[model samples]
Target: MGTTAYERVLSVAVAALHERDPEQLWPLLAADLPALCGGDALIYKLDNWNESEGTLGLSPGVTAEFTALGDEDMGLLRAGYPLAAHYASGPDRAPVTARRVAGRSWSQSRTAQLLDDLLDVDHVLGIPLPRSTTPVTGCMVYRSGRDFTDDELRLAEQLQPLLTAVEQQRQLLRRLDTPSQEAADVALTPRETTVLLLLGDALTALSIGRRLGISERTVHKHIANIYRKLGTHDRVSTVLHAQRLGLVPTASAARP
Candidate 1:
């Protein structure tokens, strides 16, 4: 019988868990997820559970339609989406727990409506990545019709940590590859460095200013300076540049 369907899925998940390259892993998972979980899924690896800074990476044949999510569209979607609240209400280890009900759940909310209109999704499956102490980064799978069954959710729960380990290791390599000294070459001031790291954590100008005890206007000044020095345009690029320069928070440093 050749190890059965569920067993084969787990085998593939384990085998590719350490692939290190999203390019390799995304397509593999995209192909396997529908068979294993019984729905079309797109994987999102975010910077924080807060839905702030991160790229929506996917393999070649995934939901290319999501490319329509412009800065404004995504801003509204992220701000209104309930991921942060979901993190607060749900158990840390319960990665497969469902948050959004069905189309009805999102029918009432503008955020859900916005995303639903764009992506034609009616349900969400969240896999909370706990490889880090704060438990921020993870993947979410969305679908248009039926919600994922309990059994499928459980399987995803089991699979979360496998991908989590890969991501944590990938971040470690990024940090290792980055020259701590290069961050200094950009000549970011101490306060500017603080802004950069917090920015990487997906903090907004208001949040960053409040945390640093500075005015939001002052915070924007620091960000503009950072952008000018690094020659980056947006938050994602700034953080990516900062990461390459070894400015992003390491797993050890991120742990609370």
Candidate 2:
């Protein structure tokens, strides 16, 4: 039997939460989310316009097409496409389609024309992440045919919290990926960070191993590496030190 939409979303949620590497999450989602949300293709952009720049990810083929735009097209994109402008001007982070945002004027709008010419798509559904700041962050769902239906829009909205969870995990992974002055001396490898985070949850070596799909012996090896790197001899102190170093979230905010 085919999976229900809810089941599919649940499957996505599980897979996303299991992902340990922040860099891999985008491609993982981009692989399946477009079809789930009723679009031909999807591209996720994170803090795209920031000075520090941002990351963009999608299926490899589409990634090339999306980023190969010429200077003029790049300039046009930076001007804030309709849905991006809508969120940038206010607090609403709801997913919106280009047709809905541009209405009757969409046919003539430069942004619409640009998308058609560039992506060969007639409509876009911007799923901006929840933000109270500039440089809207999230994915854009593109399709060549009709605009997303109300049901599809609602489905996209329902997935927002899951996306937020993934983003939160991504931020934690980012901290682990970047070494600040304090953390420079104590930086843990991505695998070690994952093990440390699991340690914070009080999972045993065997449990962590099972969760990570590794042998218990390998889990112990990672745990030992984490302890040596964090200058801790045991799980409790290791997790505590990791939290202090901002390598993992605080107790209340730790992964559930």
Candidate 3:
């Protein structure tokens, strides 16, 4: 069967996102949206567990309000809007409102208020990707003075699966940086393994000692043993080696 326009656009978006370098991804986002929706595109990393402390922009001339949205903004949205929850629950599409309270006024939704305060965005169509659990990593297509049309919304929806796959690949690449557990365990003793596991949970020597019913000095000794076994000089390296060997599951890998 022939591919639809939506399929073609979505394929291109996914390809752009999955590019090895950020240089390639940004251009596709910037150029495609202007042609598709007649408005600029803004991409955010949505890091720090609450959409804070990440880069934001199209190409650098767009002039976004929050280069990185913060915890407070996320909290407000969660408390006042249904968008976050709906996305987490696997909604294919979400609506952006301008007010905190829905059905009260167009001026009540937090999304709308942000648009009014931040940029020239009037209405937004939020097409959430599959991998995004809390509305953190998805595209927010904006119109200066117009609402999204049915065709545009349909196009965005079609892109969701590809967008999700791109995110998964990005996450997988990050995991590659962690140390392997097999490498860590090469010369580690049983006691060192236990210590490494505890350390991976962010436990200090004293805390590990308490948990293992040993003295703090003994915990330190175990950590030293762990480091020697793994051929690492520090706690971070020790834990990284443990992760690579499957000694500890990363948060990303632990997700269902």
**Count of clashes, each model:** 0, 0, 15
Question: Which residue runs does candidate 2 get wrong by more than 4 Å?
Answer: 1-3, 48-55, 78-80, 177-256
Residues 1-256, model 2: lDDT tens digits: 1268888887877787667678887787788788888888876777754323455566545767766776666655555467767787788899989789889787688877987887788888888776526777888888997889998899899877767766765765764534457875675665667777788889999987766656899989989888788778988888888888877777887854
On residues 1-256, what C-alpha lDDT tens digit does candidate 1 reach at each position?
A: 1257558766766655445343455556656654555556555555544436556655335567667677766665443255545565555646552444323555576665665776677666766665444445566676777777777777777666556544543443343233467675887654566677778878999988765546899989999999999999899988887776776655355433
lDDT score of model 1?
A: 0.62
Off by over 4 Å in 1: 1-3, 14-23, 76-80, 89-91, 96-104, 132-135, 172-256
In the range 168-187, model 3's lDDT, one tens digit per residue, is 43443333333354554375
Clashes of 2: 0
Ranking by lDDT: 2, 1, 3
Report the Cα lDDT for residue 118, model 2. 74
Clashing residue pairs in candidate 1, if any?
none
> Which run of 10 residues does model 2 get worst, by summed lDDT?
48-57
Q: Give the clash count for model 3.
A: 15
lDDT of 1 at 9: 68
User: If both were scored by TM-score, which would come out higher, candidate 1 or candidate 2?
Assistant: 2
Candidate with the greatest lDDT versus the true structure: 2
